[model samples]
Target chain A: MSDVYAARRGLLRDRCAAAGNAAALITRPANVRYLTGASPLGAVLLVGPSEDALFCAGAPTGEADEGRLDEHLRVTVLAGRGGDPAVAAADAASSVRADSLAVEEHHLTVARHRALRSVAPKVRLADLGTAVEQQRLVKDEGEIACLRIAAEIADQALGELLESILVGRTERHLALELERRLVDHGADGPAFPTSVGTGPHSGRSRHRPSDRRVEEGDFLSVCLGANYRGYRCEIGRTFVIGTTPADWQIELYDCVFTAQRAGREALLPGAAYREVDHAARSVLDSAGHAEALAPWTGHGVGLEIDEDPQLAPTAMGKLDACVPVTVEPGVHLPGRGGVRIDDTLVVRPEADGGPELLTITTKELLAL
Target chain B: MSDVYAARRGLLRDRCAAAGNAAALITRPANVRYLTGASPLGAVLLVGPSEDALFCAGAPTGEADEGRLDEHLRVTVLAGRGGDPAVAAADAASSVRADSLAVEEHHLTVARHRALRSVAPKVRLADLGTAVEQQRLVKDEGEIACLRIAAEIADQALGELLESILVGRTERHLALELERRLVDHGADGPAFPTSVGTGPHSGRSRHRPSDRRVEEGDFLSVCLGANYRGYRCEIGRTFVIGTTPADWQIELYDCVFTAQRAGREALLPGAAYREVDHAARSVLDSAGHAEALAPWTGHGVGLEIDEDPQLAPTAMGKLDACVPVTVEPGVHLPGRGGVRIDDTLVVRPEADGGPELLTITTKELLAL
Candidate 1:
């Protein structure tokens, strides 16, 4: 693990040197964790010409979720409270006599940038842009294993929820129960807030669970994920509440299931991101529910629930092997409810048997 | 409620005007929520010379937890995807012909600030500093009422947990059960992650619950909070797991209880923040436990779990009437367990019966 972290730092250093920077500062928590094994609260990683250092405001709490710190990298604990780790990293870069330091402009606030400049007047500050994010687009076998386990945990939670009686229960209670089940299955926590929408609220993305109770003949949609060791995975499914579904419910469910399958089948190495999105989106568009679609059909997932390589029309990128992404597409009819089917899969070449589905929960419309 | 939001925005406008800026941009979510009733995802509030407007990248989902948007303010939803609301707010400020725009430098990222500058080249970008936070230091009666209800909900959750069997249960499960109970009693969610520590993990502030199970003769410290209608309150207590507490456990619990009471008693109008912290620290320090103390004894709680007016040794501020804060002090001995006592209270004038304790849970040590 230490060697893996050191290798990641070495790659980031080489990228920084190519961009004419002697040192690069990473303040984004996920990015910091990707380069170094651990990311303490308010911690920053400075990959420099001389040596790499991890600056933290306080000592690491040794929590399992925070990951283990790399022993090869120097760790510095600030002496006082309320100190900015980014600024401390900048000062350390200056002390190492680095001519230029590249910082993640998308993560550091304007005030902290100013403070860094004031503290190290001789060190030139440059924007590192999304270089680190681009590097994290592809995952190694170790990271994919974590995501696989996370997806399995999410599946077990959703599977257990379906076996229970969901009718007459509030959306809030169902969501809480699923989260508890996830933790019971050994997940670090929910990757994102569990969404359980019933009746008119079903199929809406990221819907906050309300007090509305599940009713017969209503569409019930649940989207949940689990965070295992630091990797996150997502799975969403929509089902009917009663033993028999209405005609409109069956039609909407079949349409979404077909579109989702098209999106999943389009996942391949070297495929354009928008192409995969179009495979699913075109189905909904032909069905005349285009306006109700979310911005993207799917998005890359890893250390962060939402990452780069978004499968949107305007998204620019090509899929690479080992890139894990979600293919979620849904449509909500104003007062009648809707359907959504989502799954987490890793892109692979045809020779390797295509995209590996991490979340193995059944997508067929189930009447619970 | 709409009038309250308008009045808050009006106060912020006046502050900006006094600082020589005709327009101000609030990018911080909590500040935006404070100034305006609603804070949409990725939304920014622009308070200008002509009128106040909210810039949102997407349509508001009308979620109850997101609050209601003030009708008096104009809401402009961006026409396309991937557009930043802050940059749009800056462009709107420039269109209004404001000479300068004050932005929250502590919240806006450097990349976002640069984009704002590029979009509004004529308008000078000035730092808003912590003006909005300063305005939030003293909450109104309505906010206090919300906080009071939140405290009640937290107390209810903690009380229910005490009635359950605890021996041999994992800390993770106990924490999850407490959070589920909070929502069961009508909390939007937990204010922060519930902290449950057993044995060696007890009495540590912000301790991430692990798989450690409760055992007899062990000290079990649990801290949990509830967020009701956006207002948050916290409470913590430590208990002995067996029928009888050892001499050390009894001594530690008494010491922490006394320190917490001292801190609560010091919460009066015109009392210095550090003075309140010292009232608690002096007790533990005299008992030769200074090294085990956390940075601050307590802090204000409002829209955010942790707010301004931190009660720490280096903190500088005076308590004001209607200010809600927590008085939590704990000591953690490495191998042996310790104790912590925490409660939320609101400062009031001496003539008004001194500090009003919102979290009315009994602080007595209980052996379960």
Candidate 2:
């Protein structure tokens, strides 16, 4: 586990050197968390020629990361009241005689960039630019172990939810209940806000839970995940809320289930990202519901719920083994609701049992 | 309200023109919501020499706005499936033969900036900087009206929580209940994650809720806010768990209440931001609790929960009339726990009352 984070920093350091940078400043929270295994509020990672340091606004007071930090990492707690830590880091880098400090221009605000310039006038600020993100696209076995536990936690939470009498509960209450269940199952927190869309609200992407109650014969779409030890995974399932599903509801559910299966089956190494999205999107597209689709059929997930190697139409990447991504696609009728089936799966070569399905929640339309 | 949004845009346009730019692009969410009446996720507003246009990722999908587009504004809904709307806006400005465009470099990511450059190579890019944030420092009357409602909703939520059984309820459940009550009282959402700390967790700044439950003879500190029409306001109170507070609990509560009141009273039309913070800090400092104090006692609230004119010792700004802020001062004694009292108020002249209190939640420590 310690080797995973240290190796990530080592790779980043090599990329920084290749770009003619003696050191790199990381301000993105996800990247910071990835390299140092410790992400305090407003923390930055300074990977230099001499040593690697984690500079935080203040020390984190949470138990989300029990074993993420190791002795190899130097944790520098910034004073509670001080100027920007990035500026302080720039001055430190300059004083250490590190030439050409590369920074994540995408993450740093222009004002913060200007402050860094003022603090270390002699240090050159170069663009690091998505180097660490590319490094994080694939997961190591230890990271995958964390993701496995995260998925198990999500499964337990969702399984408990399935056993409950869900009728007459509002989407908001159900979402809150699922979140509490996530924490009860020992997750640091819900990876993202739980999405519980019911009745006319089902199948919408990232639907904000509302007061609309679960009704008889209504479509209930529930999507949630858990974050365990800095690793996160997702699972979504659409259910029928009555003894017998309506014909339209059953048909829509089957279509989405089939589409999600197609996307899952197409997850081999070297498969074009768009090909996976296309395989699933065409299932819904051929059925004349193309206008109701989301922009991406699926996306990579890791430290951040949504990461790189997006499975969209113009996404410029190939699927690699060990990269975990969610193949979620759905179609929603404007007024009558719709169905969406999703699962988080790690891309694996056919020789290694195809893709490793992390989120094993059943896609079968359940009736309660 | 329409006129207020229009006038806000006009002010920004004037500033851009003064800086020798005829067109400006605002990509920051809060700034976009402040300038335009709507923020439809991933949207950007383009202020031009002729007419203002809001380029959105998608059309409004809710009854929140109900097609009441301002007559003075032209709204362009992008039909594309994937891409940054800022690039579309820069292309539009280029198509219209605009020579140069000012962008919110402070908000725009370097990748997004590069996309803007690639889309419109003929156009020159300039940093609009924090002009919108500057305009947002002193909110308009309409914004104040929304903040007043937000505060009222928060107060109602907290008041209702006091009437319920508190003992044995987990911090997560209590936080969720407060959020549900906020929505029930007409809040669009919680201003931020509702903080409900108990026992040892009580009075801690930025404490994320946990599985800890309320117990007898424990201190219960809860901080929450409501978001109504994008305007946010905060209120926090520390209460005792037993039928009667201990002598130490009473002393701590009185000290926090005094500090909060002093900070609120110092919010005059011409008071320095640091002075308001000192008025609060001095009370706590004299009580021998300076070591446990937070960096800032209070901060302005509007489209964003933490806005300009921060009430901190190092903050450099004077309070202006119409500036709404929250004076929140707390002390956390490691093993003993402590107290915090917070309230949102708007700075005003003496003739109209020095600071108009928005949150009417009682400051008295209640035992439940």
Candidate 3:
């Protein structure tokens, strides 16, 4: 594990060296965590020829942080409160005689960038672009294991809820309960807020839970995921209340399940991201639900729930092996209910058995 | 209600006019919420002499927003999926006859500020400096009413939690349960991530909850707040987990309670912010706990959990009537648990009762 972080630093150093830079500064929290294993609040990672340093806001001590996760790195804790770690990292970069440095401009706000330039006026600042994120787009076996555990945690939480009565429960309470269960199942927390939309509110993307109670014959749509060891995965499913699902409910559920499966099966090592999106999107498009679709059908997931390799109509890039992505497709009628079924899977080569499914929550139309 | 948002906009317009700026752009979320009565996802308000416009990312709807918010103000929903409302407002400002436009430099990121300049090349951009925040420093009666309700909800949640068994539960569960109770009691949500620290983790300000379970004779400290209709307030209290506290626990708890009370009592209309901090600091300093103190003793809370009129030792500015602020001073021993007491109170004239306590949770030491 110690060698992993150090090897990543070496890789980044080589990349920056190739670009005519002596150092690379990482400001994005997740990227910092990936490179240094530890991210105290507002921390930054500066890698130069002579040194690799982690500059944090304050000391990182808590059961949550797992200190020294960066076994090969030394952390310099800032003394003053309200201090920017990026500026501190820049000063460290100059102290080590770093003449030119690469910084993540997309993550650093303009103000922080200017502050860094003034802190080390002699050093030439360059954009590192999404180099770290691009590296993160492809995962190792260890990263995939973490995502598998995250998906399993989400499945366990959702499975438990299916055993209990949900009628008359407000969406907010249900969502909160799901979150507590995620922790109970040993999750860092929900990958995102547990979205529980019921009845007429069903099938909406990222619908914030409301106080509305679940009634009989309503579509109870739940989208939830868990973060296990910093890796995230998502799973969404729609269930029918009462003993039997209505004809419309079954039809909608089957449609979404098919679309989601199409997107999942479309995942390959060399397919265009847009082609995968179209594979799922065409299913709904033929059913005359094209206008109601979200901008994207699936997206890559890793340290962040939403990351690179976006499976959108306009997305540019090819799918790569080991990239975990969510394939969620749904449609909602204005006043009637709607349906959504989603899954997390990793793209793989055909010889390796196509995409590896991470979230194994049953997508069958279950009537509760 | 419709007139209120319009009237707030009018007040801001008058302030900008007095400063010789023909228009002002408000980008901070809370400031926009205070002036517009409706907060979209990353929306900005541009107040012109003749026209007031609210620009947002997505197409917005709601009769109440049009009627109860600002009817006379034109609301423009951007046409694209991705567009910065601030830049759009700046372009609108330049095309219009406004000679000068002031923007919230602190809130606008360095990149956005430069982008705004590039979009509206002819517009003279000036620093709005913390003008809207200064106006928000002295909140209106309606704002106070919402904050009062928020405090009540938070108090209710904390009170109920204290009545439950706490010896075996983990800090994370306790924090999550308190949040659930807050929403149950009518809070939009917890103002911030609820803090629950046990034993050695106790008494630290802004401590994140962990999986540590409460034990016998442990000092349990908790800090939480509620958001009601966008208004927010905070309350914190520390209690022992056994039948009787240890000698050190009692001493620390009493000192913190005394300091919190003194700070609360100092909340008079004409009092200086530092004086309030001193009232709390002097008690702890005399007890030899000065080095362990947090940077800020307390701060104002309204649309934001932490706002203007910060009660730090070196802070400038004086208190004004109707300004609600928290007086939270704490001390922690590295290996031993500590205590923290906090409260929200409105600074008022002596004639109307010098200070009005909003968070009415009892300061009594409860052994749970």
Candidate 4:
């Protein structure tokens, strides 16, 4: 693991040097974790000309949630409270006589950036842009293993919920139960807030759980995932509440299931991100639900729930092998509830079997 | 409620005007929620010379957890996908002919700040500093009422957990169950991640729950809070897992209780923030636990779990009436568990009761 982290930092350093920067500071927690294997609270990683160092605000808590620190890198524990690790990183860069330093401008606040400039006035500050994120776009086998476990945990949690009596339970309670089950199955936590939408609330992306109870004829759409070792995977499914499903509910569920399956099947290496989105989106669009569709039909997920290579109409990118992405497509009617079917899959070349599905829960429209 | 939001915007506008800027852009979620009733996803509030407007990335979801959008403020939904709300806000400010626009430099990323500049080339961008946060230092009665309810919900959840069979349960399970109870007792959600530390993990501030099970002779420390409406409150308590606590446990519990009480008693109007911190910190410091103390003894709480007017040794500023703050003091021993006592209280005048305690959980050393 330490060797992997060191190799990641080495790649980042090469990228920084190619950009004419002697050193680079990574402050975004996810990016820091990607390069250092650990992201302590208020920690910053500096890939430098002399030596790579991880600067933390205080002593690391050695918490399990915060992954193990890379032993190959030098660790500096900054003394005093409320100290900005980025500023300390900048000062260290200056002390090392680095003429230029690159920072993640997208992550650092204006104030922090200004402070870094003030601390190291002689050093030219440059934007690292989304360099680290670009590097993280393709996952190694180790990262994919973590994502696979995360998906398995999510499947287990959702499967357990299906076995229990969900009728008469508020959306909030059901959401909470799913989250508890995720932890019970050895997840660090829910990748994101579990969205349990019942009745009119169903089919909405990222819907906050409410107090509305599940009813006999309502559409119950549940979207949840697990964070296993910092890798996140998402799975959403819609179901009918009672034994008999309404015609509209069945139609909506089928449409969404087809759309989601289309998106999942379209996850091929060398495929344009927008093309995959259109493959799923066109299914719903032709079904006359274009106006109600979410901006993106799918998105990349990793250490963060939402990552780059968004599968949207205007998104500019091509899918690559080993990239984990969630294909989710849904449509909601104003007063009537709707359906959403989502799955996490890894892009794979046709030669290696197309699109490895991580979440294997049956997407059949079940009438509970 | 609309009037309240309008008035808050008016206050911010006046402050921005006084700072020589005709308009201000609030990008921080909590600050946006404070000025505009609702904080939609990727929303930015623009307080302008002509009118206040909220720029959202897309149409508002109208989710209950986001609170109600203020009717008085004009809302603009960006038409395209991947649009930056802050840039849209800057464009709006430029169109209004506002020569200068102030932004929360502490919240806006350097990349975002640059984008705002690029979008509104003529408008001078200035740091709004902590004006909104300073204004939020003294909360209104309505905010305090919400905090009171939040505190009550947290207390209810903690009380319920105390009566449950905690032995042999993992810390993660205990924390999740408490969060479920918080939602069951009418909370938007947990104010922050619930912390349940057992054995050696006890008394640590913001300790992440792990898989450690409760032992008969272990110390159990739980810290949790509830988010009601937009306001948040916090409460923490430590207990012995089984009856017959050791003399060290009793001594540590009493010491922490005394420290927390002292800090609460010091929450009078016009008291310096550091003075209050000292009142609590001194007790622990005198007991030879100085090195193990957390950075701050307490902090103000409202829309966000941790807000302005931090009670720390080097903190500047004086406490004002109606400010809801938490006085939490704890000492974490390296090998053995320790005790932490936390409470949410509003600073008040001496004649009107020095402090109104919102978290009414008993401070007794309970052996569950």
Candidate 5:
């Protein structure tokens, strides 16, 4: 693991040197966690002149489940309370006599960037842009393993929930239960807040769990993921509440399942991100549900729940063999419920049997 | 409530106009929620010369807990998926013929700021520089009312947990249960992740919950809060898991209790922010525990859990009436557990009873 972290930092170092920067400061939490194994609160990774150092606002919690810092990297605990680690990293960069520092301009606020400049006036500031994120786009086998476990945890939790009585329970309670189950099955936590939308709220993307109880004829769309070793994966499934599904519910579920499958099938090495999105989106578009679709059909997931290579019409990129992405597509009609099917899969070559599905829970419309 | 949002926006508009800007764009979620009553995903508020408008990436979830936007504010749901609302808001400002626009530089990233500049090249961009945050410091009566309820909810949740059996339960489970109770009591959600530390993990500020189970003679420290109507409040308490606490445990708990009380009592209308922090920090400093204390004794709480008017040794400015802040002083003895006591209170004139304690949880150490 330490060697992996060191190799990752070395890659980042080469990228920085190629960009004319002697040092790079990583302030984004996920990026920091990627370069180093742990991301302490407000921690930043300064890679350059000296050995890469992880500057933290305070000591890491040292909780066993919350992974520790990679032993290969040096760690600096900020002495003063509420002091900015990014500024401390900048001072460290100056101390190392680095001629220039590259930072994630997209992550740093103008105020923070100005403070960093004030601390190291002689060190020329440059934008690191999405270099770290781009590096994270293609997951190593180790990262993919973590995502695989995260998906299994989510699948297990959802499977357990289906066995229990969900009727009369509020959407909030059900969501909370699934989260607890995720932890029970060994997850750091839910990668993102679990969404459980029932009745009129089902199929809505990123719907905040409400107090609405599940009704007999209603559709229930649940989207949840687990974070295992800092890697995240997502899965969504819509089910009918009664012993038999309503005609509209079945039709909507089948439509979404087909769209989601199309998206997944399109996830091949070198496929354009927008092409994958279009494959899924075209299904819904032909079904006359274009107006109610979410912006992106799906997106890459890794250290962060939502990462690079967004599968949207405007997204620009080509899929890599090892890139893990979620293919989720859904439609929501105002005042009436809809359906959504989502899965996390790693793009692979056709020779390797297309995309490898990490989340393997049955997508067939089920009546609960 | 709509009038209150309108009035808040009007005040911000006045501030921007005073700074020689014809329009102001609010991109910070809390600030947007403060001025528009609802902060939809990727939403930005544009206080334009033509009319104030709220631009959102997608339709607001309309969740029961997520309050609706102010009726007086026009809401523009972006037709394109994943469109940057800040950029769209800038375009709207330019369309209104505003010669200058002020934005929250402290919140907007350099990349997003550049995007705004690109979209509205003719419009002069000026830093709003914490203007909304300053206005939010001394909250309105209604805001305080919401905070009061939030505190009550947290108190209720903590009080119930005390009655339940604690021995042998993991910190993670206890934390999860408390969060469930918070939502069950009608909170929007937990204000932040609940912190539950046991034995050696106890007393450290912001200790992430672990798998450590409750044991005899172990110090158990729990910190949690509730989010009600967009207002957040925090309360923390440490208790002995067995019938008797060690002599050292009692001493540490008592010292922290006294320090927290001193900090709370020092929250007078005209008191300096550092003075309040000193009242708490000095107690621990004199107790030979100075080296192990957290940086800030307390911080203001509002739409966000952590906000302005930080009570720290180096924090500047004085307290004002109706300013809600948390005075949390804690110490963690490395190898052994420590103690932390926290509460949310509102500063008031001495004539009106100095500081009003929102969290009514008892400070006395109890054996469970």
Candidate 6:
């Protein structure tokens, strides 16, 4: 495991050296955790030049990145409180006599960047851009296993919720129950807020759970995910609240389910991101619901709930094998509610089996 | 209610004008919410030489900050997707013939700042610094009311957990249960991640709950807060697991309780922020436990959990009337765990009662 972290750091070092930077400072938490196996609060990873060093404001919590840290990386914990880790990392970079240092300009504030420049005036500063994020776009088998277990936890939670009485319960209560079940099934926490939108609120992406009660014959769309270890996976399902579904509800559900299936089927290695988005979006676009569609059809999900390779019309890039992404598509009629079906799938080559679905829950519209 | 938001924006405009900035763009979410009473995703507030406008990447969710928007502010929702709201606001500022504009440099990234400058080259960009944060230091009556309710909800949640069976439960389960109870008591959600540490893990600041279970004669520390409306309040307490607390546990709890009370008692209008921190910190410092202490003894809590007017040793500021802050003090002995006591209180004049304690949970150490 330590060797894995060392290998990741080696890859980052090669990229930095190629970009004419002797040292790279990773301040973003996810990036820091990627290069080093752990990320303590205000911890920064300084790689290459001489030796890799993890500069931190204080001692590691032992819970976050404890024993998993790479043995090859030097750990520097500051003695005082409220000191800037980025500044400390820059000073460390200066100590190593690095001529140039690369930093994540997208994540660093202008103030922090200026401070870093002021502290280490001799070292030229360059932007590392989204190099680390691009590196994290695809999942290793170990990371995929974490996502797979996360998806399974979410599936079990949602499955148990379906078995219990849900009618007349407020959206907030149902959401809370789902979250509790997620933990009961061994999730570190919810990937994001467990969105339980019912009635007119159904099918909306990122709906805040309200006190609205679940009613018979109303659409109930739930979007939830689980965080296991550090990886995150998302799953969403829509169902009718009563024993019999209304005609419009069934129609909307079928349309969304079909579009979602198309999107999932389009998740092939080397497929253009926009092409995958169009596969699902064209279905809804032809049905006259294009104006109300969300910005993105789906997005890559891994350590962070939302990552790279956005499945949008304007998105650039091609899907690679082992990249995990979510395929969520929905149509919401204003004041009438709608349906959304989502799944977390990993892109795999056709010979290896196309798009191994991590979220195995049945998407067929269920009436309960 | 709309007038309240307008008034806040007017105050900010006056400050900007005094600073020689004819236009100001507020991109920080809390600042945006404070000025316009709405913080739509990717929304930026431009307070300017002309009528103020809010530039949003998409339509408002109409859930959060929905009914509270100031009617006086013009809202410009971008028709298309994937446009930066800050750039749009800067362009709007340029259109209004503003010679100079101020932005929250502490919040904006270097890349984002560069993009804003490129789009609006005519306008000179100035750092807004902490002007908006300073304006939010003292709470109005309405904000105080929200904080009061948030505290009550947290107190209720903690009270209910005390009545349940807690022994042998994993720290994660306890934390999740407390979160559920917060929602049950009508909190929007937990203000921060609920912290539950058992035995050796107890009393550590910001300890991530682990799989540790409670045992006889162990110390258990729990810290949690509630978000009511948008206002947040926090409370923390520690208890003994068995019928009797060992001598050291009892002595440690008493000392922490006394320190917390001293800090609470020191919360008054015109009190130096560090003085309040010293009142509590001195207790632990005198006992030779200074090395294990956290950076800040306490901090202000409001729209965001940790706000300005931080109660720390090196902090510079005077507490004003209507300022809501927390005074949390603890001491953790390695391998033995320890005690922590915390509360949210509002500073008031001596004539009207020194400080109003919002978190009214009893401070006495309880043995379960």
> Model 6: what TM-score?
0.98
Give the alpha carbon lDDT tens digit for every residue of B109-211 in model 5: 9999999999999999999989999999999899999999999999999999999999999999999899989998989899999999999999988888888
Docking quality class, candidate 6: medium
Q: What TM-score does model 1 achieve against the real structure? A: 0.97
Sort all candidates by lDDT, best to worst. 1, 5, 4, 6, 2, 3
Cα-based lDDT at residue B235, candidate 4:
96
How well is each residue in B280-339 modelled by candidate 3, as lDDT tens digits?
999999999977887689999999999998898888889999999999998888889788
Lowest lDDT 10-residue stretch of candidate 3 chain B: B59-68
**Model 6 chain B: ten consecutive residues of lowest lDDT:** B62-71
Tens-place lDDT digits, model 1, residues B1-368? 88998998888889899999999999999898888877778889999886899988766665423457767789888733657889889988888888899999999999999999999999999999999999998999999999999999999999999999999999999999999999999999999999999999999788888999999988999999999888899999999998999999999999998999999999999999999999999999999998888888999999999999899999987999989999999999978868989999999999999999999888889998
What is the C-alpha lDDT profile of model 2 across B1-368, one tens digit per residue? 57877888999989999999979999998998888777777888899988988887764544224454577878777643676789889999999988899998778877678889999999999989889999999877878999999999999999999999999999878887898788778887789989989998899876788788899999999999999978999999999997999999998899999999889889898899999999999999999998888888999999999989789899887999999999999999887877888899999999996789999988878887
Deviation from native of the Cα of residue B61 in model 1, angstroms: 1.6
Per-residue lDDT, model 1, residue B305, is 90
TM-score of each: 0.97, 0.92, 0.92, 0.97, 0.98, 0.98
Off by over 4 Å in 1: A64-67, A79-82, B64-67
- Stretches of model 2 off by over 4 angstroms after superposition: A1-4, A63-68, A156-170, A211-217, A241-246, B1-3, B58-60, B63-65, B68-80, B163-169, B212-216, B243-248
Report the candidate with higher DockQ, 1 versus 3. 1
True lDDT of residue B113, candidate 2: 85
Best by DockQ: 5
RMSD of each: 1.8, 2.8, 2.9, 1.7, 1.6, 1.4
Whichever of 1 and 5 has more DockQ, that candidate is 5
TM-score, second chain, candidate 3: 0.97
Cα lDDT tens digits for candidate 3, A210-282: 7889999999999999988788999999998998888888888888888988988899999999999999999
Error in Å for residue B365 of model 1: 2.0
Q: Candidate 3, clashing residue pairs?
A: A110-B111
User: On TM-score, who's better, 2 or 5?
Assistant: 5
Q: Write the per-residue lDDT of candidate 1 for residues A95-170, one digit (tens) a residue.
A: 8889999999998999999999999999999999999999999999999999999999999999999999988999
Considering DockQ, which of the candidate structures 5 and 6 is the better prediction for this target?
5
